[model samples]
Target: MKKNLIKPIVAAALFGIATQSALAADRGTPREARELFDQAVKFMEANTPEKAFAAFNDRKGRFVRKDMYVFVIDDKGVYHASGAAPEALVGLTVLNTTDAAGNPLFRQMIDSTRSAPEATVRYMWLNRVTNKVEPKVTYVHKVGDYVLGVGYSAPRASADDARGMLTRAVDLVKKDGAAKAAASFNDRQGAFVKDDLYVFMVNMDSGKFEAMGMNPALSDTDARGLHDAEGHALVAEMIDKLKSAEDATVEYVWRNPVTNRVEKKRSYVHRVGNSLVGVGHYIE
Candidate 1:
């Protein structure tokens, strides 16, 4: 099942297609989803839709692993095959199909085929294995007129993700130079900011802000004496860390802008010349 169909019961009645009703099982991992997608793509590349469909729908086939399975749709939203879903759904048009979150999952998937070679989209869907509505991260790759997709349950954000974003920002700074990188990072709609993850920088020697991903107004301000809710001197700590170590992590109680709640946060700061550049993620 590709999460939730817009009208499961109506489709079943009209087309005799029952795609979402299945036995509950363990959750699928992202790695398994990627592997299944690769295999299905290989099958498609071999110009064997019939064989690919067979492998996708076969209950005992390699493609049907745990809660992960393959599904294919043409650019027109016509289903060719649905692994782990009702076989009768093969020829039906899923143009109006939406996820549990009311997102036009299939329509967006098909439309994306025209714009990019591959793209990933997220929507709320019924996890047939868990029998619960959970967020799914689907990877879609366009092959000819068809879009091959496989998705896994999305995981929660973590500190490692925050560090990776900042590391990439540091690279951009080195490549694009500080002024250009600062402009990019300051853009809230830019790549440096996603979810609760964002990049910030300060002059380690002087504690003056060079850039702040979510708060551009704070840039160029002296924040050396800033402290968290628990009175942990955050900016001062970053300067000290950069003085002794190449890179370091600082933990303190800070407000999560999304939840508007004070929570524990861990920030990973890396020394980029005279600037202490970093990003932080809230933790439970």
Candidate 2:
């Protein structure tokens, strides 16, 4: 090969390598997003406002990690810094801005911060790596006159994933007991709760909730009273199907906790002694 040709070839190879690296760069987890948020919080608490905002606004700074980035907004709902797109978002009033799902996210942040020092909000946002809108869960903290946030996109679970979770949950119940398994199922941050998929159990005798992974507050409640968006008696249907069969699959319109929308969902239920254990997945 000629010397000039060799130089251009090497340059093109380096460019290709760089592009691949960019594509392979981001795919952050919820744990990493929370860690980055905590680090940014400490940085803000230790440094002056001017220094802290500058660090947050720096896309090349430590505040920006993988797909997670620090974003700050004043109490008035004006953007102070946005590491993701500072040029387009900073210095703008985004209180009225909504997600693709029509969720009033900015106003929700302000309202949430008003009553509590910190909270988590979910909304649909475009994932740069996937070039698609997915479920985004953000951790926001109220500090002085500003609210700082960091978010990461979480993927939805498939029907097979739900079945797998249900199998593990049933195994846990068999290995340990219903009481122990119920405790694990009710744990929101535990293995039972994954993105939009969670395990729930019902007392077949009394028709009461034994465990509700996505919403523990529903535990001990009357499962029979639970109805879907279209007023379908989903739990009653499940119980009726379980009377003659070992397993039951019921479909209904339920609100997805992650997406906060009414979508078609199907739950797989099975008998574990007196309790019925189940896991559900959204159809679309």
Candidate 3:
């Protein structure tokens, strides 16, 4: 009886490990992607073009990890190798091709490699596992006549992250004053801009945006004219809520700055004196 139980326990442990590996295989973080990208570069450096392409084209090779895969493009915007789908994508001239968000990705990559040895670009790409487009950040390195690159999409920020960021932004406004806080909030590299989350503030009376974290150009835009992708007057509704409520959670459809896709967004708005400060997180 003890021996039977031991076999069952060992089998269960093996099953658990297999399950964990399966879960881990479909998802990868930016750090992991960068590490793999570095390893791929080293592999290419150590081997000839024939051997390097063979390793990259291998589906089960080390170059392919989780959702992260390696791709190589020539300066003329032609694909020489793609770890994900070599048969269909390799040898394709994609100079004019654009990403899901209409970003001229290959052209931009070519342009970037000409000026810098390495560069990073963020754009929307299809996550094969999710079958949906998500924001992807790729790091490209110029190697000989080919530009090798690797990218991974990050998980969108949760509702909790938005609320926590809002709390901090609110505290900053209360402590440092609105004018100073708006500057920090408008900084693209600032604390408020993370994943698919950002902070935007509006003047309740004027209904003009004072700060927009993702794009400061949207600042001074009339909030009343703002509408969601579905043409819902969401900003006007937010202003109406501020009339009576100290805090409100408004749901709307807005374009995610990271993914550049119109996605469901929920904003936690708080009335700070005459100004209304808000932070929104995209629903994944």
Candidate closest to the true structure, highest TM-score: 2
- The positional error of residue 37 in candidate 1, measured at the CA in angstroms, is 1.0
Query: What tens digits encode model 3's per-residue C-alpha lDDT throughout 74-154?
Result: 888877777777765667677887777798988998899889988998777766545556667899998888889998875
lDDT of 1 by residue, 1-284 (tens): 55576466545432222234445355566667777788778888786777777777786787777777788888788888776554556787888878776889989887776788888877777666555565677889888778989887653357678877988988987888777888888899888877567889888777888898768999999879888888889989889978989899899887765434587988998988888888898875
Whole-model alpha-carbon lDDT for candidate 1: 0.77
Backbone clash total for model 2 is 0
Of the candidates numbered 1 and 2, which has the greater lDDT value?
2
TM-score of 1: 0.51
Clashing pairs in 2: none
In order of TM-score, best first, we have 2, 3, 1
Tens digit per residue, CA lDDT, model 2, 104-142: 898999899999999999887776556557778899998
Provide the overall lDDT of each model, using Cα atoms, as 2-decimal numbers.
Answer: 0.77, 0.84, 0.80
- Pick out the ten consecutive residues of candidate 1 with the lowest summed lDDT: 13-22
